[model samples]
Structure formats: structure tokens, C-alpha cells
Target: MPSENQGFSVWGFIKGFGKLLIGFLLLLQGIIGLVVMLLIVGVIVSVSDNLAGGKAARVDVPKGAALLLNPQGVLVEQAEEVDPFEKALEEAYGVDEPDQVEARDIIRAIRKAKTDERVAGLVLDLGGLYAPASSASKLHDIAAAIEDFKTSEKPVIAVGDYYSQEQYLIASRADEILMHGFGNVVLYGYGSYEAYIKSLLEKLKVTSHIFRVGTFKSAVEPFMRDDMSPEAKEANLAYLSVLWREYAASVEKARALPQGSVQRYADEMPPLLEQANGDFAKLAQRYGLVDDLKSRPQQLAYLKEKFGADKDGKSFKHVALSRYLKAVGEAEPDGEAPNIALVTAAGVIVDGEAPAGVAAGGDTIAKLLKKAHDDENVKAVVFRVDSPGGSAFASEIIRERLLELKEAGKPVVVSMGSLAASGGYWISSPADEIWAAPTTITGSIGIFGLLTTFENTAAEIGVYVDGVGTSRLSPLIATGVGPLPEVAAELIQQSVEEGYERFLRVVSEGRGLERDYIDSIGQGRVWIGETAQGLKLVDKLGDLDAAVAAAAERAGLEEYDVVEMVEKLTPFQRIFGGAAARAMKLAGLDFAEARAHQSALRKLFAQIKGEIELLDSFNDPSGLYARCLSCELR
Candidate 1:
């Protein structure tokens, strides 16, 4: 408004300020970059130093030394395989670096150590190893290996401050279990529990339209009702009873304790503690739960007398199970190794491609199977399943590939892990034969459709929807509107019913079981592997090695090398993707672990977020899911 002079002055001021702001921003970015680079460099140097020292130090196990089986944590089916650089980075941060042992390596080492005459006996410094029920079932092989070791007149001695239920299971198999002065065998029985949130949804004015075919399908009950339905409770009790009974029986058989000794100890703990004058360790020994009570020094002295100690007189000369695996290299296949492909199908079954840690996309797993089928060297395939289940369409995709392998004369066998229920079982149904561990969870052959609506919530804030659609189902599950029209809900229910029927048919055809019988067993009811055998859902009760042997037998091969089929990722891809993932975690974006202590509505929303993300991976446009929502057991 002023004049040419005023205009020039204003323009010069704006240009100068803009330049100054840009310079400040550039300086800030440079500082941030320098900080980040320094952090990376520091991490690298720290990791290199630790690794150098470790490599320089010698950890030698002398001959005739008892291998120390001091597992730090639970045994997973497989140990994580990280890229070298990423491993260094994670180790530098002290995150997820060799904290747990693999079941396969444990079994391998025990077997190789059984015959190694230098191995005098085994020392179990359990060190608070917490194995899950399913993991304990998988470690039956380790127990068997120990039994074989006993034939060599070598005792398996266990010494620990305390023993968890699973730890006691392993310790009970030991020739002698030595408990610390203050330690006791705390045996907590097994039970499945899940959170429900119907009241929260009601309070938030959100509605959940759950369509499921199984009468026992309690997966959606948590959303539709305020508490676990009577049917689900009954079903849960039945399975929990079986599992508990099995556990009690096994422990009793191993330790020769009286029937219900563990149960009695658990039930009468308070009074029993009073009876023992509050000495739990003495009570445990008096009750025959432990063989003896000794302090760490006393136990160490005993082990030193049994198995010679090192020159320092403190640490026993022992071979760690993990280190012993490297000592005795993998058994080499003789002559031309006939290939027996071991393809791992671990994690939730999504639709498309997914990464390594517990997200198995259907297309990705199918590709792995197809590759194994097409490979001339692969004479047999063992499909190892460790998922609780996910999308029905994805399960069908994986099952179809197994059928293709069958058509191509490639023997396909399924080896079930801790969990192989619902979608997990769907994929396993098409296998030539199914092998499951004793405590493997399987057979929840049901389908559910979950659709959330926010109609009431919107109306609570004076929001309304008045839109025209060409078709009735056109706006199905729209964001603002929810509780789809009755007709739409019926359509989704019909689809789920059809999927259930399809599941029954698949099991009927594959397992040679009758449809009615399969339906009787389906109904979203989980069963232990032994009950599954009774129901013909599983062929033999065993582990992965047994399944591979079955595959080899089916293929008529006496000598074959077990070839693991794993997805390969380049170092650059792994490093960048992992760094991004770590950044997301650091940014408080962890999706799997929903913060439970939040407000009820917040917790419900977090759960809903997880379900929505799961749905995003599903291939089915109609959202026909075979997920066992209540099947996760820690």
C-alpha cells in the first residue's frame, strides 16, 4: 500500500529472515546427524571390544567333564538367525542375544554327548530356566537322551535355588535334584485365560458384530459378552483337566512321587508352610518334591567331587550345551545326500509377504514350499507349523500348495509345534501325515468374522450419516457407520458357516475322518496332542525329527540329508529394515504387546488395533477368518 520504496524494504527484510531461519535449521540437522553418527560409532566400538575379548578368551571343556545344561530361558523351536552386523548392533544394546537355547541344538548336543566318553555325566545348573508346557513337551527328546546317557552309568545331577513347573519337569528326570536352602518346587498348574471387553465397548458406544459357526467358538465371546460363556468355560476346563492330569502323571512317573503330591502341595501350601515353620525348602524335601536341600557352595563342592574342577577351583570344567554343539559338528550326510526339505511355517498366517519374526504370509510360505517341490534334490518335505492360526484364505493358500506337492509325488508331512490350531491346523490338514508333540495345541477348526461399527459413538456426538448407496453391501463396515444392516451381517455369517463346512470337508478328506466326527471335534475347541491322536486329528505323537523320518519313510529313502528351507534376506535389507523397526519400538509403536494397565476403553482400543492390523494381512475381501483368538498360551 505504501510505495516502491516500502515494498523493497519489506522484501529485503523477509529475504534476510528466511536466510537466517534456513541457516539455523541446517545447523540443527548437522548436530542431529553428528549425534546419530557418534552413537553408531560408539555402539560399533563397544561391540567390537566385547567380541574381541570374548574371542580372545578361552572357554575349554576338559575331557570327562559334565556338560553344564544351564539354559537361561525358555527353549524356542528355533533360535533367531540375525545378520552379523545386526547381531552386533543388537548385542551392543544387550537385546535378544543368546539368552535362550534352541530345542534342536539341545537335543543334538545331548545325543552327541551321550556317546562321547569324555562326557562323564551332566550337571543341570537350571539357573531359573523357565520352559513352557509345549516347549517342555518338545524337550522330551532331551529327557530321552538323558535316559540313554544313564545307560553309560553317567548320572544327571540337577542343582537349583528354585524350580518352576517346567523346570521341575526336567529336574524330576535328573538322577538327583538338589535344591538350595531357601528354594522350593513351585508347581503352578496350567490354565487358559483371556480378557473380555463387552462392557467397555458398550460404555464407548461401539458395537461388535461377531459371526462365528462353532457353538464353542469363544473367540468372539470376549467382544460380544461381559464374561467367558458357559460353553467356553466347560471346554476350557475339559482341556485344562487333561493337560493338568498329563502333567501330574508325567511328573509322578518321573519322580515316583505319590499321586497328586504336586497338587496337594499346591492346594495346601499356606498350611504346609506353617507346618514346616515357614521353611519352604525343608517342606518341599519332606514332601518328596525334591531329593535333597543344599546351598550353592555345597552343591558346587559335590559337583567338583563328581566332576573335576578347573585350576581356579571355583568354576567346574564343563561343556555348555550350546558350545558343545559347535564342538561336535553337524552330522555329515554320507555320499550323495538325498534332500529332505524342512520348511518352517511359524507365526500367524497372513496373505502376502511378511518378515521373519512370527508373521507368516501365505504367499511367502507357499513360495517356499513350491521351491522345495520343484527342487530335484528335495525328495521329501516336512512342513513345521508353530502358529495359533490367522486368515482362513491364507490357510487355504498354504494348504493348496501342500496339495500341489502331493500331486507332484513329493511327500509332505506336518510337524506341529507348541501351537497349530485353527488356521494352523487348516494348513496341516492337507499334509500326508501330521506329527505333534505330546502337549501341542491343535484342532480349533472354526471360522469367525468380526466387524466393528461406530454408529452409536458418532450419534453420541451429534454425528449422523445420510448417504445413498447403489447396493446394500456397498458401504459394508464403513468407518463412521457400523453394525452393518441385518442382511449384511447374515451374508457374513453365511460365509463363515461355509468356511467351517469347508474346513470339515478338508479334514474329512485329508485325515480320512468322517465329516460329522470332524465337526464334533471342531467347534473351536482346542485339544492337547494326545487327545488329538485319540480324535485322529494327528497321526503320531512325536517331534520334528519324527516327522522328517516319516517323510523319509514315505519317500522310501534310507539315507537323506535334512535341508532347512529358510527365507534369505540380504544384509543391507536386514540392517535398514531392522533399524527402522528398532526406531519404531523406540518411538513407542510396539503393536504386539498391548499395555494392559491402561484405561478399560484404551485397552479395548489397543486390542481392536491389533485385530485390525491382523485383518490388514488377510487376503479374503469378505474377512472370513480361521483365527484362534483365544489360543495364545504363555
Candidate 2:
């Protein structure tokens, strides 16, 4: 439509613009690359500085200073993994919130402070501490350490705005308990609760095919029923009641109250609050739960007067738990001492390799055991299990490795943490000795297989799957798109039954008991350590330290060094010190952010996301699980 000159001008402008756009894009890409390279170089320089001892700033512990035990996260055996670069960047931005603290670090700091002449007293600042229902064993272990610390006769004071049930357990060990004027000590005894979603799934036109052995195996109940089965309730209550009694009894003993005083306080909280005009701090004082009520400034003054003020004069002269650990350093083996390899098998068991603090990968754990077996200095191994179990196939992989260690004449001892049920018990059964804390939840021997399909939902959308196969199992290929074949379901159920029988046999052979006797107690029934010991499911009731000692004794080592074996990081991770782990908080970070301060809506969304992710993480090759969903306590 235009003239020849107009067309030529238009073509020239288009060519010029294209060339400019290309140049702009290339410049932008180069800038981005340069920025990335700069970040990497900065990280390298930081790491190099640290390696060359430039970052080795000494932590000084003042004479006559108090040891500040201010743990600021959920206590765990192992923490979740994180990316090293992201971790360092988060640290730089000062937004890193370590979600977990190791029980060993807390115990180590307390034991070290007990004999350190420079430390004058112990101060508990546990306002940010949270303990989940499963941390009963860990809590007791820490409480034991606190008790041992008091033998030095140094005054131990607990200061907090309020105390949670688990927080109160640790605080109860303090010689004097201090609270804010508006604070409350809320305690709800342990209970097991789960969301059953069968009706919801039916409404969504989805089917959940579940095959399980063990009448009490409620792991698949959420898919099969709208509510908990009566058998599950009976079994759960059996263990729940024992854990609650232990909690109350320990608190009562520590606080010097009557045997049932803790229970009475919790049950009568409403009336007690009414009597004190809803002032919880006053109610706590009346019940003798807390010794004094002090505002923040007043609490600071008390500590300063007792321990002597710091140079800044704003607080007492005290060494924080983390700083003091850095000052003293972790214990290292003195020349050629026999090593007791301590390996932690924590989190749900999955099949292949997984990083530490994630799932306990069968292959990953096997590698650690093999490493221990190959080490001439390592005389024995203590396998610490803290899991609710996961895949049956993965569990077998781990159990076989433990057997290999034993065959090599290396004694293997198992120390159960808060949880070691189902698949957890499967691997631990092969140990020379199994030790569990009095409150450790163990023994939910069960097997189950689950398959979910959405054929009905697909058909509702006018999508149909029709296929022909050469064999009866051919239709199984279209499982999620079409209805499952009857033959396939029957075969899966048979496999589950076989897995259960194998579980009973393994326990019988390992424990030297009859298979029938093991079956009687292996009906997916969960048990606390004290009860498990009585049933001969556990050899003794003890914590990790005791288990380590037992391992040492079994290995005939009069003097040995305890070495916690961990997976080696990759080159990139090692360059950044891989201090990216949740354990970094205990390792050296001096900052904390508590999850209790998160918005309720954010927490709800996070919980929902976690639930969806967990369901999606079922990666067993055979679709067979030896997990214990009912073992979780609330």
C-alpha cells in the first residue's frame, strides 16, 4: 500500500531495531553472568579466609560467668539439609532461622560447664524452646544432664515469659523458676489424632486400594475409614497413657510436688485461672510451679546481682551455650584411641541415597556402616535410630548391612530415640544390644501396601482408557488411568502378607524367641520403652550415652573415643564448610528465630503443604511400606 521509498525506510528501521535489541540482550546476559561470578568468588574468598584461620576469632568465657542455656528450636537427633550457598546468603542477610537443635550439643554444653571453674551458675532462657510430642526421650536426656550439672552445687535458674509443656519439663529441673506477670504454663497430655479422608476421596471420585497385615496397623486407616478404628484407639491409648504418666511423674518429682500434682494443675486449669482472676503468673505462684514473677528488667537485675554484670552493664556476664562450646571445642580422640562409631539413622527410611537430616536412605546408612566396618580404629558401632519407619524394601537393605557388620565381628548397638517403630525396629533387631529411653516409642511391627487411582475422575471427564495385553497383569500398566485389575490387587495383598510374616521371622531369629510369640506382640502395637523392655522387645532402658557405654563395654575397650560418623559432603559443599545444616545453630550461629512467632495462617498453609509433600514422597519400588503413621503423638 505504500510507496517504494516508504517501504525501504520501514525495512531499515526494523533491521536497526533488531540489531539494538540483540546488543541489549547480550549486555544484560553478561551483567548477570558477572554478578553470579562475583557471588561465587565472594563465597570462595570467605571460605578461604576461614580455612586460613582468619575467621578463627577466639570466644572468651569470663571468669565467674553464668552458662546461658538458651536453646531456640525443636530438639532433634538430626536436622534437615540446606544448600550451602543459600545458607551463607541467608546468614549474611541475617534471616537464617535454624529449625532444629541437636540434643547432644545441649547435653555436651551442660556437662562441660559442670566442671568448668570459670562458669559460676546455669541460666535457662527457654522462652523460644519448643518440643514436639515425639521428643519425650530427648527431653528426659537433657533433663538428666541438667540434674548431673546441679551436682556441682551451682545454682540453676530458669527464666521465661511462659513455658510450654516440654519447656516446663526442663525448667522444672531449675533450682528457681522465674516467669513474667502475664505468662501461663499450658500442659495438654499426649494424644494420638489423625485426619481420616476416605469420604473426601470418594467424593473426588478417587479410590485407595489398601492391603495391610496387623489389625492395629492404622497407617492406611485414613484411606479406608472415616474415623480411627477401635483397635487403633486401644493400642494408641496403651502407649499414650504411659508417656503422659512418665511426664507428670518426672515433673512432680523435680518440682517436689505431690505424685498427682502436675495432673491436677493441668485438669483444674480453668478453675485455677478463675481463682486468680485469669492472671496465669499468679496462679503458677499459688501452685508453687514457679518461684517468682519478674518483669524483663527485674529479671535482668536479679541475674546481674547474682552473677556480676558484664562490662556493658546491660546484662549479666554470661557465656551463651553456643559461644562456650566454641571456646572449649568438641572432644577429639587423643592418639590411637579406639573409636566408637556413632551413626544416626534418623527421619523416614527411603530407598536410595539421601542427604543427612532428610530421610534415612537405606544405601546412605549402609555406606556409613561399611565405613565403620572397614575402619580398624573403630571397635564398635552405636546405631541411633529415631524414625517412624517408611519402606519395607529399604528397611531390609539397612538390616542386611547391620548383619554384615556383625559378621565382621564388629559389635553393633542400637539406641532408640523418641521414635523407632515398624521399619525402625526392623533394622535395630539385628543389633547385639538394643537400648531405649524410658519414654522412647518403639515396636510397631506392621506391613502395608497402598495404591491410589483416579479412573473414576478421569471417566467423569469423558476420558476412557481401554487397552489389550498379552498377560493378565498387562492392565496394571494403565493403573491410574483405568480401574486396577483384580489379579493385581490380589497379588499386592499377598505380597503384604509375606512381608509381615518375614518381619515376625526376623524378630524371632534376632531376639531368640519363637515366631508365634513375636507375632503376638507384633500386631502393629506401639509400646513405650519401659513396657517394651518388660515385653523383651528392648534389652534395657537408657539414653544415648548409656548405649554408647554399653557398646564400649561390649567391644572390650576400657578407654575409647566416641566419634559421630557423618556423610562426607561434596566438593562444593565442603568449600563452603557445608555448615548449611540445621545443626549450624549448635555448631556456631549465635542467632535464633522461633516458629511460635509465625502467623497462624502461614503455619496452616505450611502444614497443608507438608502433608501433601509427605503423601507424594512414597517412593518404595514395591509400593510396600512398613511405616507407623499412628506412632505420631500430639
- Give the per-residue lDDT digits (tens) of candidate 1, residues 590-625: 533334324457657756976787667566655888
The CA lDDT of each predicted structure is 0.79, 0.87
Query: In angstroms, how far off is 137's CA in candidate 1?
Result: 2.2
Model 2: weakest 10-residue lDDT segment is: 588-597
lDDT tens per residue, model 2, 1-634: 4698899999999999999999999978965665576458657766775685543357999999999999877788897654555556556545535567888889999999999999999999997777788889889889999999999999999999999888999999999999999888888788888888999999999989999999788899999999989999998999989889999999999999988988888899999889999898899999989999999898999999999999899899999987987887777678589999999999889989887887899899989988898998998999999999998888899899889889989899999999999999999999999999989999999899888999999988999999799999999989997988999999999999999999998899888889988889998888889999999999998888889999999999998999988885543554345333433443334333323225456566567867886776577899888888888664
List TM-score per model, in order: 0.84, 0.91
Clash count of each predicted structure: 1, 0
Q: lDDT of candidate 2?
A: 0.87
Give stretches of model 1 more than 4 Å off. 1-60, 83-100, 134-136, 332-335, 480-482, 570-573, 579-621
| Superposition-based RMSD of candidate 2 using all C-alpha atoms, in angstroms | 4.7
